[model samples]
Target chain A: MILDLIQNSFDGLAMGASYALLAVGFTLVFGVLRRVNLSYGPAIMFGCYAATWVSFSFHSNIFLLLGIAVLGSVLAGTYVERLCFAPHHKGSAIAAMVASFALWMQFEEVVTLVMPKHLYDFPPMFDAEPLAIGPLSLRAEALVMLACALAICFALHRMLYRSRFGLALRAVTDAPVAAQLAGINVPRVLLLVFLLASAIGGLAGWLIVSTHTQVTPMLGMWSTLKGLLAMMIGGLGSLPGAVIGGLALGVLEAHSQWFLGPQARDLIAYLLLFVLLAWRPRWMTTSHG
Target chain B: MTALLEVRDLVTAYGKIEALKGVNLDVQQGSITCLLGPNGAGKTTLMMTIAGILRPRIGSIRFAGEEIAGRPPHAIVAGGAALVPENRLVFPNMTVLDNLHAGAYQRKDDFASDIERLFTRFPRLKERSTQLAGTLSGGEQQMLAVARALMSRPKLLLMDEPSLGLAPLVVEEIFRIITQLHQDGVSIFLVEQNAHMALKVAQHFYLMEQGKVTFSGTPGALAEDEVIRRAYLGSARA
Candidate 1:
């Protein structure tokens, strides 16, 4: 039983890493601007489609596909800002949220119209062989996803704390008015943030698509929802919280899958979410420390 | 040489009600100019207009021989003007260091030494560099606001009521800093309700009433008039 639990936990880690990346992306944009990017789900789905297409065209170098997907996300993010978010920045935040949701629906419909709803095979460059060491076994793809997630997190940490752009971003996020008085172009900073976050989302979509070896238009709705829940569970605007929340939810779902079947996995997630809501840290409940 | 800031026939309004009605003023280069007024006398509106936060309906603002009447706030800062807005508008969630860094947002050059200079000037800021501006006391936040504005190394510092809501001791400390900065050759455009403090610090003064400059003079002239005493000190002439 213990061995099974251990194996499940490792499998959970792989799932957790992908969710964590998505959570980080969502949290980064939401925490700074205080608006939900509903279109984020479609953006992720589009990223997966784009990554797979690039891999097929460019001869299956996983690294190249990942790079291409991230670039696609960045471009998509910029396009959203220019077309949807920027014009409404001064009007109403709710309007921006509605626009994002509208865009998401539009993109999903477009994708559905373009491609069939059925999942298509997408084989990546990574070997799918399971490595057994002692009494534990782990999939190579899962380990790769976990490593990439950790690396991205580390890079983000450095960017936020050590770089000039990070300093400007933090200033604007903390107080946009203050930042403006200090002469930082707030709109520009916000757009850059959108681009960076979407790129991260793209990378996450790539990771998940590669592992699952399939693509579907509805992939975004499920993953982005999980990311949002994880962000809320961890603490809104808390980067570390997003990661911890994602991992916990992933592990809980895995255990549920092991014991009560695949259908019970989402039920377990909601249960844990309820528990977290009930026992959320008092200081964190207010959000933003 | 022209004044550091020149405002001519400036008019600003909120929706329908005009706040500043065709006001004209010129702040001499490198001089500490004070604008005095009662509450709702359009002092803040004028400051906001000059700082490029508010666009006047009609006016020409010449800063250092260039027109900046309708320029954006960031552009104004880029042209060497920075404002320390009313009520100590420091970024509360951000640390003191971060707030100060935000101050230099327009400046693209290396700013490490400038930050160090600010720390040397305000040791308290250096002590609580990592502490959030919101957590600081009112006086400390005010100091942070001023320090943050200075981080831009602005040629003309537009301060809107820096002495509001503080203990007498803190008020005095703020005045001392103002004096020190003035001595260091920084041009100051001050708006305040504290008549006594404003009188002491100003080289040239403007008295705003009902959205117009009712009086403009040196400090000595304003102190000599009985009507001025009644209006400023709120005391009836003997």
Candidate 2:
């Protein structure tokens, strides 16, 4: 029983790490543009498929695959931002959301047309062997996922707090007019924000595909929904909150699957979200830039 | 002295209503100019028009002898003019130090010395260097706004209601800073409702009412007008 519990917790941590990346990406875009990029899910799927192609064609190392995926995702995100978000940025948030949703549907259709198969097996980057320490056996991929997540979070924190570009981003996020007065190019900052967030989302996609060993068109929507849920649970604009919320959601989902069976996993996870939000509406409040 | 900024027949409108109707003014180089008026007198609209935050419907804004009307705000800043916007709209989520750095966003030079210079001028900002600007007191926020505009190393500084909502002591401190900045060769274009304070530091003053410049003269010339003095400078001074 204890071994099963340990295994479940490890699985939760791996899933949480990926969710953290997705949630942070979503929150970063929201913080700057003040609108949801519904196309974010498809962007991640694009990264995953791009990585799959690189792996199949070149048998490239993990670093090369990640690089291609990130680049591809950044390009996709930039296109989405230019076509769907930029023109409607100063307009209604609902309009931007609707536009992005349409973009997302178009992206899914393209993915389906390109790869009609329901699921394609992704090439594994590491051995699936469990690394055992005493009685606690954890998958090596899980540990790697956790480590990568933590590293990305630390890098993101440093970029936001210690770099000049980060300073401009935070300023623009807080007040665009004030940022303009300070001589920061508001449109350029917005573009950089979309690129950064999309790159992070791509990294999350690569990590997810590595663990699951399968790439499915439905993964895009599912990953986006889970990431959005994690962001909402963590609070909208806070990066640390997204990480915490992602991990918490992952743990809860894992435990729910264990107790109520896998079929009840999403149902229980969403119910918890509803209850938490109802109990503390202020939990949605974001404190930091 | 030659005029550093010249506005001629400037007209700015919001939708159907004109806020600045054929207003003309000149800011002389190396001198402090003040614009005085009551609320809705188009003072802010004129300032915004000059700063390129608002597009003038009809007029030419000449800065340093070059026509700069209808330029974007950042381009205006790059052309050596900065505006300390009304209400001290400092980035609240940013730390004091970050806010100062943001002020020098267009600058590619080593701004360490400039930041150090500002710290010496506003010691309170140094004390709360890591604190968020939103958490600052009203007086400190005002100081920050002024310091931020100065970061652009602008030759002409346009101030809008620098002492809007502050303690008497803080208001005095703002005036002192204004005087010091002028002494250091920064030409100022001040907008204020405080006739008492405007009369003290300004070399030239213009009164705007109902979208027009109704009066233009020195402080002594302004004091001579009984109706203007009573309406603006209070009855005791009149």
Which candidate comes out best when scored by TM-score? Answer: 2
Fnat, 2 decimals, each candidate = 0.83, 0.75
Query: How much is B232 displaced in model 1, in angstroms?
Result: 7.8
DockQ of 2: 0.70
DockQ of each: 0.69, 0.70
After aligning candidate 2 to the native by TM-score, how far in Å is the CA of A277 from where it should be? 2.1
Tell me how far candidate 2 lies from the true structure as C-alpha RMSD in angstroms. Answer: 3.2
Q: Candidate 2's residue-wise lDDT over A1-289, tens digit each?
A: 8887877887897889889889999989988888988889888888788777778778768888888878878888988999888897567899989888888888788778877888888866696678778887777778788998899999988998888899888998898788888878777889899999999999888888877888998877987898899888898888888998899888888888998899989998899889877886665764554
The reply for model 1, stretches above 4 Å from the true place, is: A55-58, A275-280, A287-289, B12-18, B108-110, B209-214, B222-238
Put down candidate 1 lDDT per residue, B1-238, tens digits, no spaces. 4599998989999989999998989899888999887778789999988887788999789999999998878899999989999999898887898888778766779999988988998999999999988999999999999999998898999999998999999999998999899999899999987778877888988877777877788887735354245345543321
Residue A21 error, candidate 1, Å: 1.0
Per-model TM-score on C-alpha atoms: 0.91, 0.92
- The per-prediction i-RMS, to one decimal, reads 1.5, 1.0
lDDT of 1 by residue, A118-234 (tens): 776676647657888888988888888899889989999899878878888887777766677788877888898898889989888888888888888778687679889888878
Kindly report the docking quality category of candidate 2.
Answer: medium
True lDDT of residue B134, candidate 1:
90
Error of 2 at B150 (Å): 1.2
